[model samples]
Target chain A: MSVRLAITALAIGLALVFPFIAPNDYYLSVMALVYVNALAALGLNLTAGYTGQLNLAHGGFVAIGAYTVGLLTVDYGTPFWIAFALSGVVAAGLGFFVGLLSLRLKGHYFAIFTLCVGSVITLLIEKWDSLTHGVVGVIGIPAPPGLGPIRFDTSIGQYYLVLAFLLLGLFVMRRIVDSLVGRTFVAIRNSEDLAEALGIDLMRNKILAFVISTFYAGVSGALYAGYVRFLGPDIAGVSRTFDLLSASVLGGLGTLTGPVVGTIIVAWLTQYLQFLQDYRMVVFGPLLILALILFPRGIVGSLELWAARRKAMAEPRAPQAAPLAGASENA
Target chain B: MVIFFQQVLNGLTVGSVYALVALGLTLVYGILHVPNFSHGALYMIGAYAAFFAVNSLGANYWLAMLAAAAVAAIMGVVSERLVFARLKDAPPMHDMIAAIALLLFFEAAVQAYWGAEFHRLAPPFPQIVRAFSLTAPAQRLLIIAAAFGLMLALHLFLNRTWIGSTIIATAQNRQGAALVGIDPAFVSTLTFAISGAIAGVAAVLFAPINLISPTMGDLVITKAFVIIILGGMGSVGGAILGGLIIGFAESFGAFYISTDYKDIIAFALLILILSLRPQGLFPQGAR
Candidate 1:
């Protein structure tokens, strides 16, 4: 626990000082984008990683959240904070209905169903031109309003604002994952039949997990609209969902820190490999397959496994003490 | 009335292609129980294969289609052996993710090789065909005829051939087939090859009517999924019927409603059907 805390402190410390050391506005902006993506990926992790429901419609929820904020602020002239909060609400509301309809589907059916749902969302956004601006997308989204004197017009200010939300998201996620409901989600993921046998209301709990996950996606999307000031139908594209999937899977699903680490690695790789251009997915696709085959546990999960194994090896002299070690490892 | 009949003709043409593609998807799903999301990539590759054969190799349309099927069959076998086969023991989610990755890889690879510009295949049967009050392109009629012909051949092969019986046996009971001395791996490979070939052939027949591009398979593949689900996951006959149903829906929906939202008809039907009867319109094993 102390080691984990120390690492967290060090990481946050680095994040705090990152803007100062970053090369330019581009890097700061990229980091801000990373935080937004991480928040979205974390939301995905709750349902996909821990709950075991592979949601292909996560990007759709993000789109919903983004559009919500975009329309409210741009069209309705709603305040940034109000629109931001409403983004999560609207996404969760949609997620609730989608979940009610889709949670009954198991495995591949569920995934395929969600994929269609996502396409429908994108289609609606694209064809509903009068409302969503069609393929041209929502533009000139207003900057987030300042708090007192802390103006957010600058990249640094926006970066900190996004970072604060990310922290809050992480804190909430930590609480959820550590709570009883989180355990129920894990239970459902492990075995729905077993969880049901234990008197868990499978539908209710699954919907809860899905709704919370979409809420994260929504807030993340709203943040994106604010920072980028541009919203397009492509934001809700299936590719975006795949991006989140890659982050969650590559970083290690079912792990709290995996999404952040995976998002950072993926986001940075994407930035650095811009020269590859169209060839990016050509490289990434195979890499993802290789990663899945080689390290199904993901980076963080594999590291934890390695550490646990090392600890066990070092204490092999005490055979009766193994259970205690295992318990602590779970903690 | 003529226009409605014309729309029906168009629907049948489109439905036949959907049936072909959905048939392939259903076969693989029946045998392996994996959705095979990369099946769309295979379709795209098939179109590209035929495009190269016609444009670069100077093959006729029929010959190009045969070449495409051959190429895609090999690709299907290779992907099954290289990617899906390796992850047989992992969770189903892994198979799906791997399929999605393969999809991304194939799409990007195609884009890299053949730029993103859309290419039009020369129509072999461009003449207009008129029957009574309805007039249509000979290519559309050919598409409908050729798709049905291919489907008939597939039906016969699955029903009459020993290898096809092995595929069916494996789909019904993998372990049982293995116990009966049938190699499940061979069945899997064969199923993938057949699926790939069907997708390839469908692409060749359909590509001339539409523009050929890397993402052309995107919408078709989703519609194929919708058909498979509507027809029931593993039922061959269900795929056929489901394909026709969706084809008619899109045809009428596009004409009656808005063309821009024609694609949504499939998805909307999918959600509605799944909500009402999650098991789909057909029972499993109704082949």
Candidate 2:
């Protein structure tokens, strides 16, 4: 706990000081993007990582959040906070709707269903041009109003704003994962039959995870709209979902800190690997494949794994590895 | 109602393409239990192969199609052997990630080599024919005819061949098939090859009408997935029905409704099916 607190302090310190270190707005915005995606990925980690439900519809939820905020603020003239809160709520509502329909389906079936949902969302955004402005997207979205004299219109302000939400999201995720609800998710992930036989309400728990994750994705999307100040149908595209999945998997599935680490690594690689230009994805593809195969747990996941192994070695006759063997089979 | 007939004809043309693609997806998923997201990339590769054969190598359409199928089949086998074979027992998500990886690699490779522009392959039989108050291009008729031929061949291959029976046995119960002296690994590789070839044929058939692009696979793959889910996962007959349903829905929906919402029809069909008959049109238990 002390180590975790110390790490958290260190992370906060770095984030607070990051703007000064960044050379320009481009880098600062990238940092902002990193935070936004990390928050969103944390949400995704809840479903895909912890709950063992592969939802490609996350990008769609993000889009819904962005569009909601965009529509609310741009057209209705609602305050940013209200819009933000509403966006998450709306996304969660839709998440519940999608989950209610899809959660009963097993494995790849659920995944495909989510994929269809994502595509439909994109299509709706595209076709419902009058509201979303079609491919033109919703642009010129106002920046969040400043708290008193502190204007959030600047890149540093946006960075801090994104960082604050990311921290909050991480905190909430930590709380949930450490609780009974999280255990239920893990139970479901490990085995539905076993979880069912144990009298766990599969439907309710799955829906909760879905709603919570979508809420996070929704908030992330709202943050994205605020940061980027433009919204488009492409935001919900499968490619973005692919990035999230790759990052989550790269960081490690089901680990609390995995998404953040994975996002940072993946975002940095994609952002900084401009020298390769179009060939970056060529490199990215194989890199992701290797990451999924070799370090399926991700950077933080692998680190925790190494630490556990070392501790196990020191303890000598510890039988902890036995249950994990079964858990990993589910993962 | 000539317009309705024309739309039906159009739907059938497009539906045949969907059926072909879905056939490949159903085969891979049925036998190997791999969703094989890269199947679309293979379909795209098939189109590109035929394009290369026709434009670059001076082959006719038929030869180009055969060449496309052969090339795609080889790639399918290689991909399975290298990437998918190791993931036989891994979680479904791993296979999904691997499929995405293959998709990314193939799309990038295709873009690197062919550039991102859409390439067209003119139909060999471009002449229009009028029959029963409906005028249609000969290429459209050819598509339907070819689909029927392929479907017929697949039915025969599955029903009348020893290897086909082995494939079925493996799909039914891998351990049982192995206990009965059938090789699961060989079946997996064979399934991949056959699936790839079918995708190649679909791509070749559709190339004249839709043109070819690296990103085309993404859309078609998504639609094929919808078809698979609608028809019921791992059922060949379900795939055919699902494909035709999608084709007709898109045709009728686009005509009656808005063109923009045509894609939404598939999603609606999927959701409706999940709500009404979550087991799909042809449940695996029935087989």
Candidate 3:
């Protein structure tokens, strides 16, 4: 626990100083994007990673959140903060609707249903020209409003604002994962039948996880809209959801730190490979396949397994029967 | 009345193609139990292969389709060997992720190679056909005829051939088939090859009617998912019926309702059907 705390502290410390050390405003903006993506991925992790409901519509929720904020601020002239709060509410409402309908589905059915839902969302955004500007996209979204002297017009200011939200999102995620509800989610993930046998309200719990997950995606999208100052139908594209999935899987799906680490790594890798242009995904696709093959548990999950194995090796010898029992239980 | 007939003709043309694509998806899903998202990419690749055959290799339409089927069959086998085969023991999501990765890789590679510009395959049957009050392009009629012909061939192949029976046996019960001395690995490879070939043929047949682009498979794949779900996953007959249902829905919906939301009809139907009957219109194990 201390080691984990130390690592967290060091990481947070680095994040705090990152803006100053970044090469330019571009890097700061990219970092802000990273933070925003991490927030969304964390949301995805709650339902998909811990809850074991592979949501292919997460990007749709993000799009909903972004559009909510974009429309409220740009069209309705609402304040950024109010629009942001409403974004979460609107997205969560849609999430509830989708969850109530689709949560009954198991495995691939749920994933495919959500994939269709995601496409529907994008289609609506694209075709609803009078409302969503169609394919023209929502433009000139204002930066998050500042409180008093904390102006957010500058990239640094915007970066700090996004960072703050990311921290808050992380803290909330930590609390949720450590709570009873979080355990219920993990229980569901492990075995729905077993969890139901234990008297868990499967539908209610699944919906709750999904709603919270979508809420996180919503807020993350609102932040993205504010940070990027542009919103398009492509924001809700299936590719975005895949990006979150990759990050979560690469870092460690069920772990809290996995999303952030994975998003950072992916975002940075994307930035570094910018020169490759269209070839980036060509390279990335195979890389993702190789990563899954090499470390099915993801980098963090594999590391944790390694650490556990090392500790088991160092421990005093136990009875042969005891080791066999432990192995079965773990499996 | 003529307009309705025209729409029916259009729907059947598109529906036949959907059935072809969905049939391939359902077969692979039966054996692998993974929603191979890359199926669409393979379809796109097949279209490009045919395009290349005609444009670069001077192959005729039929020869180009054969080339596409051959190329895509090899790709399907290679992908199964390299990616899906390795992740067989991993979580189901891993299969999905790998498929999605393959999709991204294929799309990007195609874009890089083909420059993302839309290409039109020359229509072999550009003549207009008129029946009673309804007039239709010969290509549309050909698409329906060819798609049904291919489907009929597939049905025979699945039922009459030894390897086809092995594929079915594996789909029905992997362990049971293994117990009966069938190799699951070989079935998987064979299923993938067949699936790829079906997708390839569908693409070649359909691409001439519509422009072919790197992303042409996106909508087709999504609709294919809807069909498989509506028809019941892994059910061959269900896929065909579901494809026709959706194809008709889109065609009729576009004519009667808003064209802007024609695509939404499939998704809307998906939500409604899943909510009412999550098991789909067909029972499981209807293969």
Candidate 4:
């Protein structure tokens, strides 16, 4: 408990000091984008990582969130805060429909269905030009109207704004992971049959996991729109879905910190390797394949395994004298 | 009436090609249980190969198609042996990610070699054909005939040949097939080769009608996926039916509904059918 608290404190402190530490607007903007992507990846981890659902419509949910904010603010002149909340709500509602689909389909079927849903979402965005402005995209999305004198028009302000949501998102995810609900999610992932045998309602839990994840994706999308000040169909493309998937898997699955760490590494690599823009995916594809084949557990997962292994080696003689070490050894 | 017939003709033509792709997908899914996301890229590669054969080698169209299929078959065998074979026992997600990786790698390779610009194959037989007051391009008929012919040949191969039966047994029960002395690795290699060859043929057929580009695989893959799901995984007849359904939906939806939502119709059908009949319309061993 003390260690977790210290880590949380350190994270908060670093995030608060990050904008000032960044060298320029470019660095700050990159950090903001990383936070945005991390939030979405965290949402994805809830379903794909924890509950054993492969959701290829994450970008679609993100799109729903972004477009909600874009349309509400641009067309109706609504406030950013209200639009943000509405974005999550609308996206959650859509996620419910998607959850219903997940009920029937399993494994690759569910994954493909989500891919189709994602394609349909992008197509709708392109065809519904009146609302989305078609391929022209919604430009000049208004920045958050500052609360009192604290203007968020600057990079530091936007960084802080995005960081606040990311931290809050992390806190919520952590709380969920610590709860019995999270245990049920893990139970479902490890073995649905066994979970069902234990009287867990598969449909309800699956839907809840999906909805919660989509909620996070939606909120992140709203934050993204506010930071970037634009929205487009690319937000819902298959590539974006793959990007989110890569981030989730690259960091570590089924861990709260995994998504954040993974997103940071992935975002950094993609941004810094701008020279490999054309061949980046060419490189990324093989790299991802190698990761899946070699380190299916991902960076954080490998670390966790290594830590566990080290602890086991250190305490082979201690046995059950230390309950925490003993329990993990059994696991 | 003429318009409806024309739409039907168009649907059948498109559906035939869809059937070929779906067959490849279904075969791989049936045996390997890997969704094989790279199948579309292989298809795209086949199209490019045929294009290269005609343009660079000055080969006839027929010879070009055979070359394309042969090239794709070899590539498939290599991929199965080097990458996919190692992933057989891993979690399904691992295979899926690897396949997506392969998809990206293949797409980039095609782009690097062929450039990003779209290429169109000139129709070898450019004459117009008419039947029952419905006129269409000869290329469309060629596509339909070729697709159906390939499918029939595949059906015979699977049902009649000794090796084909061995492939079916492996798909049904891997452990059982292994116990019965069927070499699982050999079956895997052969399955991939055949699947890749089918995709190659579809690509050759598709290239003349549609613009061929690296990114062309994206749309083709999604459509083939829908067909396999609608048809029922591992069901040959189901693939044909599903392809036809998609083809008709796309054609009629474009004409009757908004052209913008044609793709959506196929997806809507997929979701609806999957919800009501998860096993699909023509589940294997049932019909």
Q: Return the top candidate by DockQ.
A: 3
Interface RMSD of 2: 1.4
TM-score of each: 0.97, 0.96, 0.98, 0.95
Clashes of each: 0, 2, 0, 0
Better of 1 and 2 by TM-score: 1
Error of 2 at B161 (Å): 1.5
Query: Which lDDT tens digits does candidate 3 get at residues A1-331?
Result: 5877898899999999998898888899889999999999999999989999999999999999999999999999999999999999999999999999999899998999999999999999999999999999999999888899999888889989999999999999999999999999999999899999999999999999999999999999999999888988998989899999999899989989888999999988998899878778898899999999998778888888777777677877687856674874475
Model 4 stretches with alpha carbons more than 4 Å out: A1-12, A316-331, B283-287
lDDT of 3 at A288: 91
Q: In candidate 4, what are the lDDT values of residues B1-287, reduced to their tens digit? A: 98898899889988898889889988988888888888988898899999999999999999989988998888888888878998877777778878877887888878877888999987788899987777988988899998989989999999999999999999889999999999999999999999999999899987888999988888778889999887788788888888998998899988999888787888888878877887666656221
Residues A1-331 of candidate 1 have per-residue lDDT tens digits of 6888999999999999999999899999989999999999999999989999999999999999999999999988999989998999999999999999999888788999999999999999999999999998888899999989999989999999999999999999999999999999999988899999999999999999999999999999999999999999999988889889998889999999999999999988998889889779998998999999999889998988887788678765676787887775553
| Interface RMS for model 1 | 0.8
DockQ head-to-head 3 vs 4, winner: 3
lDDT of 2 by residue, A1-331 (tens): 4776898799889888988887888988888899999988999999998889999889999999999999899888999879988999999999998999999788888888898899999999999977889998897889988989888888788888999999999989999999999999999998899999999999999999999999999999999998888998999988788888888888888999888888888878877788767667788888887776777677887888787666656765646876875575455
Measured with C-alpha atoms, the lDDT of residue A251 in candidate 2 is 86
Is model 4 an incorrect, acceptable, medium or high docking prediction? medium
TM-score of the B chain in model 2?
0.97
Better model by DockQ: candidate 2 vs candidate 3: 3
Ranking by lDDT: 3, 1, 2, 4
Give the TM-score (0 to 1) of chain B in model 1.
0.97
**lDDT of predicted model 4:** 0.87
lDDT, model 1, position B61: 94
